[model samples]
Target: MISMNCFELFIQTYFTQLQVLDISRACAGEYINGFRWEQLISTSIQHLRIFALQISFKTNDPLMRENTIQQFQSPFWQEKQWFFICSSYSIMFDSYINLYSINPYRKKYYLLGNENTTEIDSMPFVVQLDIQCENV
Candidate 1:
């Protein structure tokens, strides 16, 4: 499992020469705010054209949930055309909020969970879409 700091370092260290980046496995409890914590991305990954990352955080705080979407509303990421979507799901005791990019560098697979989800941009070629919902 890679921490957010490690992901940041990975990008800073190697993304300069890469064009696309994707992290398949979920990053446990790593919260990312593009507005407050992504200055390094625009500057560091000069050659990065597409970035696909999924970050998860365990929380039920409304502010944290809102920030998951609010933080990515900045032009800092939009201008680069890197967009993301935030999802909030409550599975029993734990509430998991995930933030992931929807960049169109490859085949698109979008998943919408049972809880609330917010997306910054839309993907045209959605090969797969999954939605899960259950009454609590």
Candidate 2:
């Protein structure tokens, strides 16, 4: 059984990987100084069965948002079973949140949402993925 702390660590690592991918994709056309992390992930972490990607951008411009969406929907990455979660609020302020997951062999994305937002002061979103491998 995975401990609570270990699970938290796993989530953090997943978030980090997603951030790196987003940054790389956004700057793909530009002359970047660093190598892509996707190559490293493909070489290492062979046992990884699930990937979660989350992208957050703080901007009021519509064109920037469109560009960000385009980068995420690019075909440079292989196609796999994907799960996407999106939430946005445009009331007093504007905010958008999205999370994505890919798993080759199983459905793993989990959704947890709160029932009441009246008492809460902010929007909350959750995406969870479970991955397990069995030896044949």
lDDT of 1 by residue, 1-136 (tens): 4456765675455334545555444444443656534665566655555667666767868677677787787877778777888888998887888888774455343445445456425432332333333322
Residue 3, model 1: lDDT of 50
Quote the positional error of residue 78 for candidate 1 in Å. 1.5
List ranges where model 1 is wrong by over 4 Å.
28-31, 107-136
| Model 2 residue-pair collision total | 0
Cα TM-score per model: 0.63, 0.34
TM-score attained by model 2: 0.34
- Local accuracy by lDDT, each model: 0.59, 0.34
Off by over 4 Å in 2: 1-40, 43-47, 55-57, 83-87, 102-136
Instruction: Give the Å error, residue 117, model 2.
Output: 33
Model 1 — TM-score against the truth? 0.63
Evaluate residue 63 in candidate 2 and report its C-alpha lDDT on the 0 to 100 scale: 54
